[model samples]
Target: MRYLPIDNQLFVQNRQRLAPLLKSKSLVVVNANDIMPTNADGTMVFRQNNDLFYLTGVDQEETRLVLFPEHPDPKFREVLFLRETSELIEIWEGHKLTKAEAEQVTGIPQKQIYWTHQFEQIFGQMVFEAEFIYLNTNEHTRAGVEVQTRDARYIDAFRQKYPLHHLERLAPLMHYLRAIKQPQELPLIQTAIDITDKMFRRLLGFIKPGVWEYEIEAEMMHEFLRNRSRGAAYTPIIASGANACVLHYIDNSQQCQDGDVILLDIGAEYANYNADMTRSIPVNGRFTARQRAVYDAVLRVMKEATQMLRPGNLWDEYHREVGKVMESELIGLGLLDRTEVANQDPDAPLYKKYFMHGTSHFLGLDVHDVGNKYRRMEPGMVFTVEPGIYIREEKLGIRLENNVLITESGNIDLMANIPLEADEIEEMMN
Candidate 1:
């Protein structure tokens, strides 16, 4: 791992929070994500399963975590099964975690080491003893279907082997528990935001008239890798001019024009936690008068929406209120007509014309971090208050985003130091 070692206490606390949610005499199992295949014997880089990492802090592939909290044997209560490294395997690939090393990486003592091949026999024996099985699957509603995960394969085998055991979904419990941020997770995310800040600051100098969008993407990646971040949280969207109007635009192939505005939706990931940030700036280091007006409108909406991220508020309800705030901004921008809003569909509001997509989502382990969207906001839950106005016809789109953590009194912006105000971004660019 390029990132620094994390304290095992975070994982220990996470496990404690998860164990009580399981059924009595239940066994919970989690597996690492599969190394996705490309054509012709090639594979993509491995990413650890978020839930497994949240519990064990083990980032390697072919790893397994078994939590049988009600077990009589203390060693069997929390066990980690690691891929045994051989001399030949080490020569073919690189160093895999050694037994003692896994112990150091994860604070699960030395005795808990079990080989990957021995998983079936061990799990079968353990499942017989437990009454319920907590199976982990990706229940993220927004999850894309481009690739199948290792957990999907395991779920197939699991049902065939233990059909009698009551199966429990781990998603709901994980969604609820992982929603709350730990003190340790915050530093890693803040570190990621700091790295992202450096990348964006360096970007001001890199971006200019006639520069290719891919070049800006390259510059951001160079800065991210230097700061120990694995490039971007999502594909860097370096869209310039009308290209910026297309949400999720990532084909950074166009040349930025002198007076055009470029929207950068980028962030850095550190130690698995992610920071999401989006900033819109002019290609020539200063915004046009009209550009500044649209920019200010979006920034003001973001600022006002962020102030609403407090305890006891429903996320859906908050966004609805944010919609009203955005409606006024859209009116100020002259994008929404008063007549249209009066007769507009309540289910599909007038703001959706200029401002589509949700204002915020939980941000942490994933760019769109896992949280109970239906539940009310609570202290420790983090969200990104992003508001944008995409006037495709005018070839202008302005989105300003920041990471906010819900506090007891209110919410704190993690990216508060990073420039957001039109004047501040302009000052930095100049």
Candidate 2:
């Protein structure tokens, strides 16, 4: 791993917390994500399953975690199966985790560590003893699963093997546990945000008219890679001019124009934890009068929306309130009038024309991280406060974002040190 080693206590505590939530006599199983295949003989870089990583800091392929708290044998209760290393394998693919190394990294006893080949025999015994089996699968609200994952394959095979064993979805329990950030996880996220901050600041000096949008993206990747980030948490969106009006613009093929604005929706990932940030800047380092108005409107909305991210606030209600704030700012910017807003359908506000996407989303292991949106906000929850206005007709788009942690007292902006104010951005650029 390019990132530094994390303390194992975080994973230990995560397992301890999740154990109580499962049904009695349950056998919990989480498999690592498969090393995905590409064109012939090639494979994409491996990414560990977030749940598997959360439960046991093992970031490798063909790994499995079994949590059978009620097992007759204490040693079998919490077993971690790793792909055993060999001389030939080492020569071909480098060294894999040793038993002692895995034990130290995961805080599991050395005796409980075993080779992946032993999983079928050990898991079979546990399945016979346990009444329920908890299986992990991707259940993110926005997930579109076209490819069959390792977990999916396991579910199909396991059902055929033991049809009588009561199966339960582990996603809900995992989601609930992961929703609240543990104290140790905060530093990893902060590290990612800090890397992103460095990249953004570097771009300020590099961005100018005549530069290609991809050039700006390359600068971001360069900074992130040097600062221990595994490239972007997601595909970096380097949208310039009218391209910025497209929400998911990532073509990054056009040259930046002097009067145009660039919407950079990018982030850095450190130790698997992610930071989601978006910032809009003038291509020529100075916002025109009209551009400044739209930018300020979005900035005001972003600030007001951030303040509403405190504990006890409901997500839907908070977004509705943010919409009202945005509506007012849009009116002030002459994008929408009082009469238009008054007659507009409450369910489908006229503001959708200029400002469409949600103002905030949970940010963590995944860029659009998982958390129950219907539930009220709580302390330890981190969200990205991104509000924007896209004026396609005027070829102007402005978005300002920061990662914020919800606290009991209020909220803490993780990107607070990064430039946000128009004057500050202008000053930095100049």
Candidate 3:
């Protein structure tokens, strides 16, 4: 792992929280993500499944965690299975976790840890004792994964092996638990945001009228690596000028022009926790009057949305309020007529022409972290407040984003120290 080790207490506490939510005699299973293959004899980088990591603090492949809180035997109540290592395998792929190492890393009892090959026999004995089987899967509302996951394969195998066993979805339970950050998780996220802040400061001094968009991307990668981040939390959007108006623009092939603005949507990933941030800067280190105006408007919306990410706030209602705020700003910018806005189809707000996306989304383990949108915001929940104004006709787009943490009293902006104001960014660039 590129990131530092996280305390196993966090996972212990997470399992404790989940145990009570499960029905009696239920056995929860979480599998590590498969190491995906690319082309001939090539494989993509391995990323441990977030849910598996959350439950066991084991960031390795071919691993499984089973939680049977009501098991007749204490050892089987919480067991971890690891891939058995061989001399040839060790030489080929470095060290796999030893039984003792797994116990130390995951807080699992060493005696309870067994090799992956023994799972069939051990799990067979445990499954018959449990009345219900809970299996994990990617249930993110926006997820569109085409490839089957290790968990999916396990689900198929279990169904065929025990056709009469009552199976249950574990995603909702996981989403509910992972949505709120634990005390230990906050520092990891803060570290990611801190790394991104340093990179942005460095980037300000490097951006010039002639620099290629890819050059800026290179700078971002360099900073992230040195700071121990595992690159960007998601694919970065390094869009310049008209490219910025294409919401998810990632083709950073164009050259920056003196008067054009570049929209940077990037963040660093640390220890599986993530940061999500966005900023729009002038190529020549000075925004045009129009650019500054649009930038300020988006900043205003971002700030307002950040404040709304507090306890008791519903996700759907919060976005609706942010839309109204954007509508007011668009009218002031002469992009929307007040009469036209008021008369526009309530189903489709007129402000969407300039600001089409939601003002905020849950942020943490994943860039778009998992949480029940309908559930009210609570303390320890982190969110990304991003508001943008895209004007394709004028070849301009302005977006401002920050990570926010909802606390008992109010909320804290994780990226507050990072440059956000147009004047501050301009000053730093100059």
Superposed Cα deviation of residue 112, candidate 2 (Å): 0.8
Q: Quote each prediction's TM-score.
A: 0.98, 0.99, 0.99
Model 1 lDDT per residue over 160-254, tens place: 87788888898899999989999999999999999999999999878889999999999999999999997788888889999988999999999
lDDT of 3 by residue, 7-57 (tens): 889888899999999998999999999999999999999998999998888
- Which candidate would rank higher by TM-score, 1 or 2? 2
Question: Compared to the true structure, candidate 2 yields what TM-score?
Answer: 0.99
> What global local distance difference test value does model 1 have?
0.90
Clashing pairs in 3: none
Give per-residue CA lDDT, model 2, range 1-430, as digits (tens).
Answer: 8999999999999999999999999999999999999999999999989999999999899999999998998988999999999999999999899999998899999998889999888777777989999998899999999999999999999999999999999999988888899999999999999999999999999999999988998999999999988899998899999999999988999999999999999999999999988999998899999999899889889989999999899999999999999999989988899997999999999898999999999988888888898888999999999999999999888888899998889999999998889899899999
- Model 2 scores a C-alpha lDDT of 0.93
TM-score result, candidate 3: 0.99
Worst 10 residues of 3 by lDDT: 1-10
